[model samples]
Target chain A: MVVNSSAELTDDEVDRIFRALADATRRDIVRRTLAGEASVSELAGAYSMSFAAVQKHVAVLEGAGLVTKRPRGRERVVRGNPDAIRRAQRLLDAYEQIWVARIGRLDALLDDTPPQQ
Target chain B: MVVNSSAELTDDEVDRIFRALADATRRDIVRRTLAGEASVSELAGAYSMSFAAVQKHVAVLEGAGLVTKRPRGRERVVRGNPDAIRRAQRLLDAYEQIWVARIGRLDALLDDTPPQQ
Candidate 1:
């Protein structure tokens, strides 16, 4: 099911999503936003970094489509995009399928033949 | 299920895993290795880059615990590690759970009241 939903993501998009998620601060930001949307200022206040650094991290997440920014009273509110998360989930699912099939083959090889019922 | 298995990986390991997966060529190598084990030379031939380049990609993958290399006579054979894949899947699974719960709350908020059966 995850793999079926995977076609919409470009390899570049996958690269960006994974790269953006590779950092601790960014992942925490994603977690925070996914639970409830927050502004850059709110996120920065929670971390030990400067507002600009946190803004950069938010920008990376936005570029990867993992989070979205919308104007709200002169502040940009960031919310994690579930669809983008699902896309990355699906890419990993495809890889999971590959190994599942490979393991199935290995099982068959070890069995020598189908077991009698 | 993936979330349950996610406890085995530390945040640092999760970072390494995603960082390694952020590259297109590295991701391709993971797919190929999951499908079937191959020597470094064989993998190098399949790509446009030099053997050392492919080797570096494999090193990154290995560092992230995504793949394993074993000596086979004259060369090292590479195979994708299912456990590592599962660990990364679990991390995403945690994020998925967060959003799923958030959506449930949103649905509750949008509902005027419980629908009559």
Candidate 2:
């Protein structure tokens, strides 16, 4: 019944993931967290924006499953989720395949025809 | 000078590609065109929206390099471009690699430590 079993996240899921990634601030958060888990304050310090803005970005990333927050003492540390990124990559790969198949069909059609005047 | 040579579209390029893909109508346009080249009217017939709206979506796809419009008599036939899709896929692949490397570092850190009580 399911068309794609691998990384077949629903459109809603893709929307959430992509929307979260749409912002440069959130992207920077993902990139920084990828280096290692960091507390909210630590991430806030790197940006010129308000701490609340950075917090909101982190929340968006968490909602998209791109980042996971764990409690450490009084702080919460956020870590990047590789599986989620892999799922997003798989979706893009599917789109790539669709285009490839289209090209293949055109090639077949061209091959079937004789030299044109 | 370039950080990523593999499908390394600039931020502006990514913004355009993702913005073009952000719409459901444009996504449908890409999907339909992937099946085969279609005239604007033919593509318009499948959707409830106006032909002009469909044409706009087609234009967006063309701008994103996802579709190529070729003149055929009075009608322009739109064909999908596999190379652009591949380029986009490579960008997503690079993001996936970033997350994977992040996880690898975490695993390495954990391996260095003994079981905690």
Give me the overall lDDT of model 2. Answer: 0.76
What lDDT score belongs to each candidate, Candidate 1 first? 0.89, 0.76
Over B1-117, each residue of candidate 2 has an lDDT whose tens digit, in order, gives 123335457666665566666566777777777777799999999999999989998887787777888999999998876666666667666666776787788899899889998
Candidate 2 off by > 4 Å = A1-7, A106-117, B1-7, B106-117
DockQ of each: 0.78, 0.44
On TM-score, the leading prediction is 1
Deviation in Å, model 2, residue B68 alpha carbon:
2.9
For model 1, the stretches where C-alpha displacement exceeds 4 angstroms are A1-6, A108-117, B1-6, B108-117
Kindly report which residue pairs in candidate 1 clash with one another: none
Worst 10 residues of 1 chain B by lDDT: B1-10
What is the CA-based DockQ of model 1? 0.78
Model 2 superposed RMSD (Cα): 4.8
